[model samples]
Target: MEFDISWILMGFPAAFVLGWLASRFDLRQLRRENRSAPKAYFKGLNFLLNEQQDKAIDAFIEAVQNDPDTAELHFALGNLFRRRGEYSRAVRVHEHLLSRADISKPERERAQHALALDFMKAGLLDRAEDALARLEHTPYENEARLSRLAIYERAHDWPQAVQIARLMHSHNQGDYSVRIAHYLCEQALGQQAQGQLDAAKDLLQQAQSEAPHAPRPRIELAHLQHKSGDPVQALGSLMALASVSPSSVPLVAPLMLELVKTDKRKPQVRALLVANYHSSPSLDVMQSLVQLDEFARVENADGPVGRDWYVEHLRHEPSLVAAGRWLAQETLSHEEHHPAVQRALDNAAKPLTRYRCAACGFEARQHFWQCPGCQSWDSYPPRRVEEQ
Candidate 1:
């Protein structure tokens, strides 16, 4: 056999030409497909830039239809739907992405997160809770847990909120001790409402251990003690609070006066209150002093402290509240018109007695642990509006 060297050389060139032509054809087809996707995408982008949301959605729909397998395009479309407040459509797109088996783990997690956000934005809390639970072991775990915590708070599910907070705390997410204490206090309040005094006490004790420096648990515990006819114990807890949180002395002063009156410990309580008042000069402490002195005057008809304390307070601060108190007991020269003048002074001073939230400046007649206006905890100082 000759082995045909010329034929072999001719066959090589023919095969090379065929291969080149095949590659060109494939490249042309790919370029056409690529060009079509970008043209639709740019049209959508242009519509979006022009603030034509309806037209942008139409262009995006066209682009998505042309490139149905593109995860990025689907994500963009889903987010657009969500931003437009079209929750149902956003849910559909994300659900479709989740149904695809070819989606990577990270992409699936992202899609799940997006679906949860859609439910939350649409006020479907039950559905959002389920979706968020599924994200627990994913990379979005922390964010999902935080959202779940917020949901639990809104639902007043304190135990579940505490569990999530503890988990986040163990993972070093942020300091949740104070929040946990608040949950315990809330649970204690619920128990108290149900006439479960012992259980409420136990929860409050736990709350105190959880956040030793927090004022709410101790304050609430004192209230419970006072309710149970144990004003002495209540006084003890309040004294502990004053020792630990000296700035909160004003908050406990009135309670101290009541406890002292009930227990016949006025002299010691008056001394403690007078020292604290001299140091801080709070309106609450001064008011408590007035009460203590008035009680002493009844016990002894000519007590020196009873009628002179308000004058001393006036000397220090020139306070309108102090002046009003002093004027209440004075014998004015125009006795016929004194009642009308006193009524006017009291009306003008009424607003000064309200409590104001430090965070939002929302004023109320009673104190609050959380600001109703801004939903912030520990925002209201334990003082009257005039004191602030």
Candidate 2:
């Protein structure tokens, strides 16, 4: 209480020295912690680059423990877990980050996306869908919508797929007209299966209107028409398709051949098949032309026979399939061995006739609008492997 200026001055200097020492100690400790966290993170990254996932995960765990509040560290660890197929751990880490209220908006969205990815990896589609739904209006909206589209497609929820596809198309994300058409076609098929012929026809017509140049809608519509006992209309649809998408003529040739019941339109059908064959020379179209020619030969004895077309095809291209087809119809000089030769040729030509996926190289006897192996649309070309 008494005035002690000398004592007060000594106490002030001593307090200043203590404060400086304490601050230096704290700064050193902080620097050491920062260095340790970075070291662990880098170690994890190095392990990952070396393809040592277990070591990388261990290192990441250490880094996360060293910096519990680091959102980026949490993200890295969660991603690592997801990549390692430890989806539960990945979910826990991302959920922990999401529970932290101190994270920024962007960080929260990022965590949400990560959590959705974890759910997807875990095959918790319902949960993944719910998580993805929350990402709308965020930066991850487009990606989330695409993921949801895949989920809808997988579930065969064509209506939902169509809705999402239309939304993406309207948003200028991408031209989903073809995809929408496919969804409509799928729905049409389902309707057709349920004997809702009129409804199926309506959906197919809408699909055609949506993507006029697409081949599947026309082909599907023709099939439905044929199924509905309107062979004439089906033939007309297929003929129009040949004009619109010439590359699809091969697909429609068999259907056209089946629908040709009247002798009056035989000439017109023959001309279309002949024209298509001249342009593309598809084996399927060639087969259709041969059948028509054989029918014509029965009408006029002087007309060229069906087997003559194979020779003409051979003149255009050296095709094993053509050779085999020609040989099958030919009267071989050694008739006794013909059966064995035919069997060998048929065996060799079988695989070449299979359609192959352009995306995944999955070969099938029948053509597919979508590759079953890769879940890719329009992956398989309309033509067979030999033509390719």
Alpha-carbon RMSD, each predicted model? 4.1, 1.9
Least accurate 10 contiguous residues by lDDT in model 1: 298-307
Query: Per-residue alpha-carbon lDDT of model 2 for 102-199, expressed as tens digits?
Result: 99999999999999999888889999999999999999999999999999999899999999999999999999999999999999999988999999
On residues 1-388, what C-alpha lDDT tens digit does candidate 1 reach at each position?
7687999899999999999999999999999988888898999899889988888888888888888999988998998999999999999999999999999999999999999999999989899999999998899999999999988988889999899999999999999998999999999999999999999999999999999998889988998999888999998898788767767788778888888787766676777777777777788888888888887753442322654667777777767777888899899898999999899889988998888988889998877876778867888887787767
Cα shift from native, residue 335, model 2 (Å): 0.8
Q: How good is model 1 by TM-score?
A: 0.83
Worst 10 residues of 2 by lDDT: 296-305
**What residue pairs clash in candidate 1, if any at all?**
none
User: Which runs in model 2 stand beyond 4 Å of their true positions?
Assistant: 1-6, 298-305
Off by over 4 Å in 1: 1-33, 39-55, 298-319, 333-344
